[model samples]
Target: MSHFESCWNPASPQALQRRAALLERIAALRALEDRAAAASARSQAVFDKRGQLLPRQRVALLLDPGRPWLPLATLAGYGQDTPELARSVPGGGMIAGIGWVSGVRCMVVASDSGIEAGAIQPMGLEKILRAQEIALQNKLPFLHLVESAGANLMRYRVEGFVHGGSLFRNLARLSAAGVPVITVQHGSGTAGGAYMPGLSDVVIMVRGRSRAFLAGPPLLQAATGEIATEEELGGAEMHTQVSGLGEHLAEDDREALALAREVVAQLGWAPPEAPPAFAEPRYPADDLLGLMSDDLRQPVDMRELMLRLVDGSELLQFKPLYGAATVCAQARIEGRPVGLISNNGPIDVAGANKATHFIQWMCQLGHPLIYLQNTTGFMVGKDSEQGGMIKHGSKMIQAVSNATVPQITLQCGASFGAGNYGMCGRGYAPRFLFSWPNARTAVMGGEQAARTMQIVAEAALARKGLAPDPVRAQAQFEQTVALFESQADAFHTSGLLLDDGVIDPRDSRAVLAQCLALCADAEARRLRPLSFGVARM
Candidate 1:
């Protein structure tokens, strides 16, 4: 009792008041921290609901783990008159920086929708343009995580006017300078100003979350009296399958980021002087003969074949979803970055248009092209006719012809009709046009050929007063072995040099790697002007 009384008597009123105030201040600070944490959590939840991911998460997933992200402009929007706007649109809706992707230092821009709906404001546009300028100056590969609502209408109204011409001009200059630009659509990218991602060398969309269109549904309805859902208007399915806008589609944000990393791996560190070398152990030691099958019409998932061929699981595919029939990707064979284009069978006109755009961009980026041919032809039907297949298909052919990269063609199965030309056929004269033994090259598939032969044989037999034996008539047309083989032989004998020789499908990686190594020192040539518009997004 004596010790308690003495301690109670020691504290004065002033001292007690000071202690209480300190405690209150500490409590307030804790509360503020809690509020910040809760806001961050809510933002993350929004991304989760859309099956999308935050910029930080995308950076972590796409880049090498543990590498520091040296942000370019964390306080981008914090200018004298725009303090409130900065607070509202922190980082200008974009998280841009130099980061390590699998140890490759590159410039990356990740869009953050938490601020200003990820719209491109004056400050945001300036931030991106500055980042791009840095990338170009440093000769670094540019990776864009696009989730914009296009231009900010509110900001534009406040500013009187906003012009995208400067942004497009800079992108065009960067592209012309040969910097590889890769884009991933993490959310809706719409309107006239959204074309930046479209103009990139490669574009990958996350299935449900990503969409690219010239306008939103409301705008479309206002303009054309067309009322449609977002999915039908510009979802990943629509863009990839119908609009010819997106290049590839992923199952989710994680996969999209993973694919982006793979794309960077394929590109390697760039100077464009020498292609990267593939790891030696990754090459197939045995001939790849067994990998081929005789069935021409069978659909082999080229994606699987590519994964097996590239080094270190580095098959970076572009526009995997949009052109369901055509496969375009980036990959490394023994470490060399190569552009891969393959047939996914019958894709619509939109797919063809996207494919053409992709190939043109690759050529402009100064990357070599690898063609894997196995297409029947372009899609045909009322829908295709209306979609302008001829115009788009012609564009693809023109792009292929104009490509100055060291082009290599691998005929895996059927390379029929215009599909062959689009895939760098003998006419385009790829540096090396190799074929698997199972390849069937012709104006059309054997079935169509057989039908034409049947009609001709039937007419001849009827004129000869002999019944056309349906069996023998078909047998006479069974020149699958002779005709295609002769075609292959003719390609070789014409001194047109069909291929180095027929290769096993499994050994494609090894063959391509060796060819790339041989051509690494080849001079980079410029393709003719195929695009009038600047690359935008």
Candidate 2:
């Protein structure tokens, strides 16, 4: 047995110093997350007065207790509404994730009604759209604990209104695809938002609180000169008893959540398949916390990561000595067959060729592929070009695009340039993609980009027969680096929904297991298709 030797020294001063810095970065991020949570918690008092549960409380009630909840895009609108990053609360005005509901995994979306009366924030619409997409793709039943003030008309943009239609369209698509959507309209779903409940497979409404109307009283009075009370127009009782828009009517938040969970259980979902015999990793999961580095330029030992991830920490490295940068290994994560591709450095001609072969091999074996991305991209310069880097790289990409298997990607560090494409970045449509908080994704490293710009500027100056000012050039380089670095950070990428979410390193194994199970179940379950989605009665 060729067991991998450990070179990591936790007791070394350099290791401690690096960890301390990384911890501070992690803590600062956690502090911002805490602030966002506290902001929502503060509004619990207001919810209590109104005989309603807070948004998170509703999610908690909806989900099966003690089941894992994998929250996504917690920083969706961070640093958007204000310049103060610390003061600006993200979460896109919603709480959304995958969790167990009625012993079945489901995609749960809840309005942060406690804050801003659940009014959608800057990027809130985009966040929900991504969440909807995940649910549709994963075939998870959708449960919505909704109470939104709809779009902020005062700060409305035409683009937001135009794109918002997809949210409804996706709901219909989810139903057509045999995925169930269960909604609980805890409050307003006015104007265009009325379609939310209208499009769902099943909808639950709170007796007096839930409202689903094309227009509110003021708009009804203005448009048709019809003076109607809130209940007369779109109240929960009217929808359930008269309008037929809502299927189930509940007295309050708790009851509404209960109905949503019950609906999930009644959706004809298949029970989980018994997994293969699993073994715990020989290494501690806590080691993952210190495994990652905030500096993207630093190299990561793929073998070490694999040791901590796979069953028994036992890995069969494929071509260990050849194509050394691109590390391919056969292993079982949770005892299910999986092939892993990770980077020790950039992808050169040999590495790309090796990966191409490995991807094909994995597909033939009917094993899912897991990509641990940490590359600066394919090798550049004269030596690489002469070695047929382009040819080999193209071959790898073709294999990745055509491979018939589930591919999951985790951005543990820099996922830059063509490396991102080859390794299944967001564009490649990996079944699932997640990122570590310390990870960064961009066309290239910030320093690399800035230096490239500097060279271009120097050449432009040479063409003009003018010498560039050293001071000005240095300033420009600094500014360029700062902008790129900030935008490439996980917080910024996650806010834009570039990846599923920014996850803590410690939770990596659990997250991957959940995803693996979901993918496996999807592959196994049979679907019944009709020409169109289930129509409203």
Candidate 3:
């Protein structure tokens, strides 16, 4: 054979080494491609099953469609010796980065269950903390898609002993910064640290899937005699109704994501948008005054009234299941964003808790607030007291006071006592406060006032030698119409602006739009500062 023919032969050691090296390199590249494909497939499976967009998907939905998510730590956990516990924990469980949501920029942490059942290990916590820090430093909104079995059990013996406190500290700092944290409980969230979701400004739960709690049922049973199912302990219903842990319950994953997107859209990454300028009045003259009920004592569904007033079906109610009595939501008036806080008139304590949560969320978002006054008052009694209504109520009040957003009050009906103040009374100084002609502003309802006056009359009769005459008493009360009129005067002239002039219910939307437009320019000037501190979880 010729020298060239011999050189081409496969039996030669030099040629053999060359072939082996090429094959080895090809194998390695193929292996890498397969791994990537596997990860993509795994993420897809999660999305398909739950109708969930991964953390990346969420960022895409929230951020402008084309912005790239700049990962904080792409190779966060790839070199550790413990394959299961180290290299995969951080990047695999929590995918965090700075990205744009709509055009608004934000930092987001998404859970990846393909890695260790989406457990939060020490490294995972570190990644989250770092991302939170970035968000706070940049004054960006922080979005967390919480889906984990709390802390990782495998690393408990090693990490639990050393860095357990770090996670909570970081969570607290993010909260303290007023970063406008939004948490979507996508799946199982339990234990002490998992409750971080509760500390967020808005906590959204997936209807039948997502759950959150300080501890699971078994743990609760072990600590105390109380035994309940997972759903009973920390499911969507329990959190929204019993503990007020979740601020919003979505019908499903898509609905939850849509709500999140809507919330973020309304609340841009930085300071909130000013209320829009008033467009031409939308409601007819008759519809403007029609919302007010003549019978002050009769309960009216404020939600219906809000629906009629807000532009389009743009009203987004928050925590509806939690606070049925206090309706808190975000709505558009003539296309201007405004926070709506109204009374459900007759709802349970759970409903009040939800309302409190919704209002707090709105305040945190810095959206302009609108109060649809109609409340007998907060639910009273021992049961309510036990549920920490006072504490939660105080939180609601603080949220209102701390809100830098402009506020406007619309006294639709009964504005009684503390409820009036809590719903942004004239004392709160809404930019422009108006009341419907039928509104009654007082410490209590007119009927109650009349009854008290009747009691006084009866006592006077008892002192004399005469029985209280029902017919005469009734006539005397009617003649004392001045008592009712005084309430209106006190509300308007004595600072409540009773003379602010009764707005026609139909004209209310136009008035609100005008208020929003008037404030919009000023609100744009308010820049949100980067403030970070620890939070109570």
The candidate maximizing lDDT is 2
RMSD of each: 30.9, 1.5, 30.2
Pairs of residues clashing in candidate 2: none
Candidate 3 per-residue lDDT over residues 68-172, each given as its tens digit: 445544334432324452122224356776565655556778776555557765555666666665565445678887777776665566646356566566566
Candidate 2 residue-wise lDDT, 250-357, digit = tens: 999889888887887787777888798899988877676676677666667878887888888888889999999999999888878899999999999999999999
Instruction: Please provide TM-scores, in order, for all candidate models, with all chains considered together.
Output: 0.44, 0.97, 0.43
lDDT of 1 by residue, 422-474 (tens): 88887886766666545667777656777777887788988999888767765
Query: Which 10 successive residues of model 2 have the least lDDT summed?
Result: 1-10
Lowest lDDT 10-residue stretch of candidate 1: 1-10
Q: Which ten residues in a row have the lowest lDDT in candidate 3?
A: 1-10
Ranking the candidates on TM-score from highest down gives 2, 1, 3
